[model samples]
Target: MTALLTLAVLATLLGGTLFAVALDRAYLPLLALFTRQRVETEAPDRLNRDLAPAWYLALAAIGIAVVPFAPDLALIDSPVGIVIWGSCEALIVLTVFLHGWSPNAPFPLIGAYRYAAIGLPVMLPSMFVLIAAALPAESLSLVAIVDSQREVWNVIRQPLGLPLFMVVALAMTLRGPMDYADAADIATGTSAEDSGAGRAVWQIARLAMLVSVSAIAATVFLGGPLGPVLPGPVWLWLKTGALMALTVWIGNRVARTTPSRMLTILWVVLLPLSFLHLLISGLIAL
Candidate 1:
């Protein structure tokens, strides 16, 4: 089990990175459809400022590395597994902010600000979902959360929770319609100044972050490794992949939202809805 868990973590990180790299290349042809003629490929001039791509990568690596182990397969399961996972996921946002700010470029700076502006609002709602998940388990251990769903998955019990969490996950990863951080309107936004291997690392980190978050979501709501007929690890991976695909599809079909509008919706709509979900979940638990 230890070996399997370790392998799952490594595979999620490395595999997600490679998948993201390939996805970027694959999207090139499609991206051209909406791009104006004569899209610029020039690397932005670096500000006379010290930059550390390694720092960005290191932080993201640390943040995502611990998430895959949050389920039953965890090598070091603790009562606070949910808190640990949440902290790590939050670090990904800081990593992005630093990645954008470190370059000291105009577009990237604005993009980083946009990322924070939209990213922060969604976090409370996401936490509400997490709280809802933990309430039934009566413990913060992610494994406990999964075990609580043995009789029935949390998605069915708290139907609003899964979708709400997914929406926040999309925003957290800056994917799909919530991709204003790297939106085309801002010359790829926070990544505009990146080039060569530096850019590659950044892209990989983003993808890995997405994979890690999806894995957590699976564990929290989908009853990780609790499916019938399949091995635990297989079930976990299958669910993670499905969630990742759903997130990607949503991003592809939905129009990109501006940071301000996203903030408005998050505060006025998603926030209240998440609270209502929590209320419903608590009532059901009783």
Candidate 2:
């Protein structure tokens, strides 16, 4: 378990690296589509941008390779299990913050602020859900949670758990309507400065990494790598891909919401939903 978790953490960090690279790549088409429209803002410096592309890609690839070690990592049975779980959430939060701050563009900066602002409320509810889900075992090790879920996914056993985690995961992963960070218009955003291969990396590889990590979260909290016939890795990949597709579809099909309105909706609607799930979980425990 210790080893597996370490691998997952590494994979998660790699996801961040890939996301940064892919973000640069994905912006090209957008730039081309809206050139000279005031939407095609120039990047800070070409040299830095060019240099970063390859470096970030290497980081992402290393991250993916690191994923397989998760199941072998330390279990959440120790006194620090809860602390470890919180750290996972923190690591993700920190990555987004870096993405926002590291860029020399207005949009990335604004996007970073938005990312941090919105993250606060959503993170609280999600943590509560994780605690409730793992409370039964009195440990925060994901391996132990999976072992407990032999008969049922945590989502099934604790109805609220899945929804709460999903809500936060959506925000953390910046999927669907919650993607205010790089919404095409608002700030011109995180992907604003990327071009050429940089844009491609952001669009494809970065999206792939996000999708993969989100899927793993689902597997850990929901029911990892589960299915009949196919092996665990295969099942995990399939489920992750499906969720990624959903996120992309929503990003494409839906109109981007203003950050203020989006945060309001998340806190007002999802917060209650997550807390209610916690209440239900407590009842189940009793």
Candidate 3:
């Protein structure tokens, strides 16, 4: 099980960066992780600046630990894996905000507030979609959730769930249209002051979160580790990798809309729709 977990973690962590590096501009940022000097802002919260990246990465690790490599096999197998993952998602919002707040700069603060505004709204749809996925399994355990999809994956069972959850994916990973925290318009947002290894670690943590979310998405909606012939871990790795690629592709392609418009859409449309998805799922399960 340890070996299985080690493989899964390595595949997830490295794939997050390696797949992204294929993008033309991404390699330099990675190279900078090693070669660049540490950047500090005026009156920065030194503690948070250092700790936020570590915390972000740790949360990503914790999120991955719950993913089952095989039946009843995981690093920290919990019955309420969905909730555990959700908790991590919630904490990330705080972490990103702190990353901005630590810099004590106007642009980063703007970025931080923007993220909070959007990220908080996005969480409702996320949990709703997750709960909708949980309906078929009648259990919150992710392994059970995966087991429930042995015959029919949730993407097919609950068609609305995956697309809605994609918003959550984009938000949690702080990428694509949802990446208000690190948007270029705001001077890379919360990371405007960050440089050197500190910035690199944060970037890597973001990618790791992206991988973590994709893996969870694979587990809930795509019948994780359920492929024929291949070992469970290998199948999981493939599914996770595919989802990672799909996520990055989508992030790169999508453009960010204005924050005010996004907020209206989230509250007026997605939140209610996701709630309906959960309601319908409950009825179907019953």
Candidate 4:
């Protein structure tokens, strides 16, 4: 039984990794083709080559880490679970900066700067939720949190935490309309000079990574791996996919905003909300 469960988790992780690869391959090319058309007309083409491979690889790595860690990871249930999980999130953020800066293009560089600038503040709410989890479990291990939530998902008790986590995750991924950092209209976005295989990797990996991160967040804070009729892992995945759909739909619906405005919104609006959520979650823990 243990072996079978392990295999199932491994398979899910593999599927996520492949999905990331496929998405990266599919989209990077389209972006390149679009840029080519613009370049041909002497309009402007900014996609850089350096951004693709590394970005895809980074996405794949995050996919591997976030997916398997959802329902179970012995390490994440240990004393240092918080540090491990938080570091994992930080790594993903770092990869975003790397993807933005490595391109050596003006737009991508600017995008990286914006990404770094806004990333920290938004992550606070999620971080606080994780901290709150530590309070109850008396440990940082995710397994402990899951065990605690078996009786009730954290979302029920900490409603605000989920939305804050979602917003941060979406903003970090820059999907849909939240893509102010890489807003295509800006004429100075992160992926302005990539092409061919490189472009393919970046686009595919990024979308996959976004989906994977959403899934991870859902599992961690949204009562992942918990359902009465369905199996725990299956329930976790369903919730994760649902969240991804929500993010994509939301992303598509919103109009593009300027980076400065996005930053302002995060600072003035989202930050306070996130901080409030954290405070409330702390009270819930109490």
**Candidate closest to the true structure, highest lDDT:** 3
lDDT for model 1, on a 0 to 1 scale? Answer: 0.73
Q: Write the per-residue lDDT of candidate 4 for residues 239-278, one digit (tens) a residue.
A: 7667767776777677866667877887788778767776
Cα lDDT of model 1 by residue, 1-286, tens digit: 7787667667766776556545545445334433434222345334311243454455445544444343455654678877876676576566667767767678988988898888777788888999999999998877788889889999999999988988887876778888868988999988887665556545555666667777778888888778878777678777877887777778778887678888898899999999999999999988
TM-score of each model, paired residue for residue: 0.85, 0.68, 0.95, 0.78
Per-residue lDDT for 100 in model 3? Answer: 90
Tens-digit per-residue lDDT, 1-286, candidate 2: 5676555555555554344334335445545644433223445544444444344334334324323222333323344444454555565555555555555778787876887777766678777777777766555655565556667777777876655565565665566666766666654466666555455544443454465445545555555555668865555555655555555555455565778887887788877777787788778767
Candidate closest to the true structure, highest TM-score = 3
The per-prediction tally of clashing pairs is: 1, 25, 0, 14
What 10-residue stretch in candidate 1 is worst by lDDT? 44-53
TM-score of decoy 1:
0.85
Report the error of model 3 at residue 113, Å. Answer: 0.9
Model 2 residue runs over 4 Å out of place are 1-85, 200-205, 226-229, 250-255
Candidate 2 local distance difference test against the native: 0.57
Candidate 2: Cα lDDT at 102: 57
